[model samples]
Target: MVIGAGPVGENVVDRVRAGGLTAAIVESELIGGECSYWACMPSKALLRPAIARSDARKVAGLRESVYGPLDAMEVFAHRDKVVGHWKDGGQVDWLDSIDVRVFRGHGRLHGPRKVEVTSPEGERHVLTARHAVAVCTGTRALLPELPGLPAAHPWTSREATSSDRVPERLVVVGGGVVGVEMATAYQALGAKVTLLVRGGGLLPRMEPFLGEHVAAALTARGADVRTDTAVSAVVRDGGTGPVTVLLEGGDHVEGDEVLFATGRKPRTEDIGLETVGLAPGSWLDVDDSLRVTGSDWLYAVGDVNHRALMTHQGKYQARIAGAAIAARAQGGDSALDTGRWGAHAATADHAAVTQVVFSDPEAAAVGLTLAEAERAGYRVRAVDLDMRSVAGAGLYAQGYRGHARMVVDLDREVVLGAAFVGPGIGELLHSATVAVTGEVPIARLWHAVPAYPTLSEAWLRLLEAYRG
Candidate 1:
């Protein structure tokens, strides 16, 4: 049985059925989960037009023609179409074809191996799992506790992504992926955007240069990128007027809409974790196979496990967990391969996790940063390349300002991590992911020649810089 039919849960059930096991999935909301409706799909849809226009503006002859603001309505319409107008019929049909039982309700742990589901009509049903129960309830946007925030009707990630109309003025409070991406989208769609980052830099989790490039680009696009700014309170008169965000000092910024993209908390608050001797609202600890710690039958996949919050990472975990459960059900512990990089192990969660921020001058990275690699006690060398020097990048854009950094493990002679910050660099991330995940040696990478006159040639440049 799977609780919360998000992408993670759906993947779990799909894999379980593929493993020749009967499965049931329970969800209170849509079948495809957050990625299908609110978070990834809609957010990316909103970003693509903005990014495309921005890229076009950088081209030589095309720059003059694409300078106008995006058609906000058309962009919203396209976004709506991408999300199937917030419908899940197709997703439901796919599940039906898979022969997976779907329970439309709020599913909670009744006890060991048992789930109690309450439907929207308040009808109750209990299900007992034959092998395992996977909890894939993803997270919701976390709004900080501040004065008048709730009363002011602040927008979380869901509202930010799914809103039909763009606000005239948007005050985004966070430096994370959601904050930067939305700021980029709204600014391009003809909104005055003020991005408030409590931290000193954006994309703080990645290399420092990535955030630096993104900040410069956002500022160049006329966004008010404020760093080290802390919000003390927020107020909106009559709950329908402009939101006034009070800063730590005697200062404030007003906007037609305020978005809090500070962070995310697990959605396990009311999923009956207390019944299973776990905290009611906490991230579930899991082993390499995604099974909840100290329990054989309980597996926590996706954001609920706090392994890697990205949808793709969650789906990866689901695949591993589903396979592990099947193996255990078939032939006990002997049937499972629990070693690192094994068929049932999610080792990549620790070693080769990848992320791409859809902000202007896209930031993509995999594995460790230079700081992260050094902190991990590896003997590392940081090789840097100005992406503008690459022939392909120069042809791709007029200025083509960007940077690439590859952290090499000197002892092992393998790529430890890599980050690229520039326009259209999102596609260049997978090669880095492959290098880090495969632990491909620096010598071997030198032989893996990159195609000339492409942004990918940045790899060859990085290798040459490392050789120097």
Candidate 2:
């Protein structure tokens, strides 16, 4: 039995059936999960229109104007269209075609080989699993405990994505991916956006310069990006009107709506996990093999297991878990370790890997930041360069201020990490990712050659700047 039919769960179930095994899918929410229906699907729907309209605003066909605003209704409609109107009839048919049984309700583990599901109509069935039971129950949003904040009208990612109306003024309480993306989208849709960040800078997870570019681009787009600002409390300006936010600095800002994009925590609560006689956070842990610790009959995958939170990463984790379970069921020695699979392994968790912030200008990064590298006791060489010298920059935009960095293992003569920030540098990350993952020697990486007149030429330029 597969618990949670999110993308990861669905992928696992499909894989199980393809192995000629009988599998049942249990879901209590939308089948496609956040990516297909809410998080990625709708957010991208909102952004694509702006990106296309912006492109059309350039020296291109029809050069249409008066396209003026992003119609939220249209965006929502498009999202629904992509999700097939949120009707699972199509999904249900496909699941049936795959010969997998579907159980609609909240499912919980009863024992080592037992799954108990409560149907929507109050019907209950005890399913005795003949094969392995996989838990793909994904993560849930983490809400910060700010004083008097819950009383105010606050929009989670869900409320914001499904919004049919745009607020006149918006206060986004976090500077993470969701906050910046929503802020940009709504700012384009004509909202006065004020983003408050508790961190020292935005995208603190990436390089400082990358964070600077994102903050600059957001400010360029008319968003008031405030770093080092925290919300003390949220006061309902009562009587069904706009909300007012009081910052820790004794200042106040009012907006038609407030959004909380703080972060996310795994969804391990109230699922009857304790009945398994396993401790929380430890037993539900997915090993490199994607197996639940101490139990071969049970496994957990995706964000709920806290493996990797990104939808894409969760799906990959689920795929590994699914394959492992299938192999074991077929009586194969499927005992696998997470140490191998460079870039594919859980190695990145211990050693930081490439990550890019997908804000307007975008920021790409791989491996440790300068501070982190130094702290980890690496004899390091770090250099930063203006992105314009690289051919990739000139092609990105006539007026583009980009940044690039190269972190060298000075002793090993290899590149430890690299980062690029500015328009279109997001794709340029793959080259850096390859370099870091392959542990490519700096001298050899020079010969890895980026095409002429491309942003990637920045790689070679960065190498030169390293020596200077």
Task: Say which candidate scores most in lDDT.
Answer: 1
lDDT of 2 by residue, 1-468 (tens): 888888888888887776668899888887777777778777877766765554344423345663577786787688678767666777778888898899999988888878899988989998988878888877666788887677785898888877877789999988878887888778877789999999688777767887788889789778898999988888885535788889987998889899999988766675667778865433267676577778868878777777556776667676666767776787654344445663224555445355656566767787777888898999998978898787656655666678899888889977777888876677888788778767788889878788888888888888888766
Candidate 2 regions exceeding 4 Å error are 18-20, 52-68, 237-239, 279-283, 331-338, 342-345, 348-354, 411-415
**Residue 202 CA error for candidate 2 (Å)?**
1.0
Show how many residue pairs clash in every candidate, following the order shown: 0, 2
Off by over 4 Å in 1: none
Give TM per candidate.
0.99, 0.89
Q: What is candidate 1's lDDT per residue for 1-468, written digit by digit as tens?
A: 999998999999999999999999999999999999989999999999999988898898899999887898998999999999988999999999999999998999999999999999999988999899999998988889898898999998999999989899999999999999999989989899999999689989999999999999999979999999999999998899789999998899999999999999999999989988999889999999999999999999999888788999999999999999999999988899988789999998998899999998999999999998888999999999999889999888888899999999999999989999999999999999999988998999999988888999999999999898
lDDT of each: 0.93, 0.77
The global Cα lDDT (0 to 1) of model 1 is 0.93
For candidate 2, the TM-score is 0.89
Instruction: Count backbone clashes in candidate 2.
Output: 2
Q: Go through the candidates in order and give the C-alpha RMSD of each one to the true structure.
A: 0.8, 3.0
